[model samples]
Target: MIQGPCFQILLLLGVVAVAAADRRPSFSYSAPRASSEESGPAQYNFNWAVNDDSSENDFGHQETRDNDNTKGSYSVQLPDGRLQTVTYYVDGDSGYIADVKYVGEARYPDSDEVRSYTPPRRQYN
Candidate 1:
């Protein structure tokens, strides 16, 4: 009949928010229990391919060949989260052309290590 102090601080924050929502803690939605010796084995093998006309301004290529090697890549997505690939490999019998690098934040020399296309360290003291 006579309260003030913002009505006793909003009635002591509504009785401490209804006694903290009656000691809040209630959840039930179970559906995760698997076994079979802990069902392991099966993380991820390997397989690659994604060159079907990438969109979003065209920049998303991916390839992976095997038979000694022959890879190709081209990724882009750097608004900050960091990622900007541009790989290239082809060492099928010393035809070692390389690219997938971050070898110290970028720096290409040693004539960029070519093979069948030349420059397999023709000279470099």
Candidate 2:
């Protein structure tokens, strides 16, 4: 039987041999390069809106982009009976800029019309 240092060396060699015998494949990834002719600024335009009187949901957004410049606007109906609109734009490195406007005056219910809330009691298990 192998003894002392020889036994330890043999055990280490066996472990190394088993590890080296593994044939699992290795993997790598690289992004595809864009062709020189295809290199150009991105441009697109899109708009969508949703208005439902039953659920009282009204909001929309539209944007147009040419190269590095972008322009867009979005509007929504406020619960206070006001139409809130925001117009914005972005030009190249210049950050986003916006202008907000409201179409109607806000209104609130009188003190007598407002109601107080009550919490229900919880039972212990």
Candidate 3:
């Protein structure tokens, strides 16, 4: 019974708001699938994300020491395909990848962790 231009505009606004709220981007990752038939640690590439590419989730990680204001901290993926949060310190002028550790398990990966390889041994010269 409420038919008016104002009602239409309000309905449109409500729809837009709902759409925006539903479009939340996920910061979590997918863990790689590993087969038990294999041996040793399965290789799972990390989804490394720089500070610029991180979401609000990174700010609330427990590894932050409850300090959500950490400036040098970043999110990355580990070899186990685990999504990790890495912290870095500025070395001179440029920033480099520092300490990398597993923060948690990733929710996605390009490949599974079923296969892992080692480099050939070489004698030191």
Candidate 4:
């Protein structure tokens, strides 16, 4: 039978071994919850990343939702080093609309004019 210092050392080792055996690395993660009647309407979101090392034709895209409308915006680098952004949105039965803008000290084409030009109908002789 062990006694004194030897007994104490053995007891300490046994306790340490038991504690180490009970220890293990653990990981936990929670996934997103699904939308249900109790949880209300569903949500939508999207994001994309572009490589900056690519050529001028490279572009970036992003999308988001608000109420009944979903909008998407795209950004691209033009040959003249100016950044161009185009955004569009779609809602219920209202259809889709888009707009373009130039982001730089100087804009291209200077200005833009939209005219509602309608051609006249011709009568048969």
Candidate 5:
């Protein structure tokens, strides 16, 4: 593995780009929320990275409640080989979700660091 100067520069730039993009996450759910807490439906983004067993495929099983929403329960894979689940709910333009529950290799969800879930930050539960 050659750590050339040019390669290092490119790597740095790539890291910067990824960081910026991650900071600005867009809702990938069907029933996306609007800014209007009174008229528009609530919006949210929840995802977890499943690094269990370091599988080549990154994916997670999740159920997105909101029978009226376009889609429900989607298995999504992140950039890395990690699995995660994201769901959404509308509470009068104020949506709610259980956070990106990562199904670890144990084949179950973890309860640690459950407080990370927030309106903007993608929390895990």
Candidate 6:
């Protein structure tokens, strides 16, 4: 059997050989170029709305985009009974522009009405 310094040298060389064998070679890759059809201008139009009377959720949004230009509008029913609407647009390199408008006057409950409120009772399971 091998002994002392010779045995240690052989073991270290064996370990180095195993480590070198486990190493993988590095690789390089280049992404493929996009074709003409895939690079074409973008165009889309979409609109959605939500009106839930029970939960008092009333809001909607609509937008149209062609190439670098886009136009849209969105509105929501405020808690104070006003309809808040915003119309906006973006043209090419120009920044976003918007106009806001409200349909109805805001109203708040009187002090007596707020004081008459009562919390609902909780039931044990």
Off by over 4 Å in 4: 1-42, 54-58, 66-68, 105-125
- Candidate 1 root-mean-square deviation in Å: 16.4
Clashes of 6: 0
Give a tens-digit lDDT track for model 3, residues 1-125.
Answer: 77899899999999999999999787977888787685753323233333323222222222221122223555644545466656665434454547767756665534553355343454555
Counting only residues 3 or more apart in sequence or on different chains, how many pairs clash (N, Cα, C under 3 Å) in candidate 3? Answer: 12
In terms of TM-score, the best-performing candidate is 6
Provide the lowest-lDDT 10-residue window in model 6: 116-125
lDDT of 5 at 111: 60
Best-to-worst order by lDDT is 6, 2, 4, 1, 5, 3
Candidate 2 positional error at 75, Å: 0.7
The alpha-carbon deviation from the true structure for residue 114 of candidate 5, after best TM-score superposition, in angstroms, is: 32
The segments of candidate 5 whose C-alpha lies over 4 angstroms from its true place after superposition are 1-71, 96-98, 105-125
**Better model by lDDT: candidate 1 vs candidate 5:** 1
lDDT of 4 by residue, 18-106 (tens): 99999999998999877664654546888885654533355789998877788999988775667789999988678888899988764
lDDT score for residue 4 of model 3: 96
Tens digit of per-residue lDDT, candidate 5, span 2-101: 5899889999999999999889766765876577555545344444545344334544544443433423344555543245665544444455543455
Model 6, 57-92: lDDT tens per residue?
789999999999999999999978899999999999
Model 1 pairs in collision: none
lDDT of 1 by residue, 1-125 (tens): 85879889989999999998899688999897776575443332244444322322224666666556667777654433344667777765777565653222433335444332342233335
Q: Where does the lowest 10-residue lDDT sum fall in candidate 2?
A: 115-124
Check candidate 5 and list the clashing pairs: 42-93, 50-83, 58-82, 59-83, 60-84
What are the TM-scores, per candidate, against the unseen true structure? 0.24, 0.64, 0.22, 0.42, 0.24, 0.69
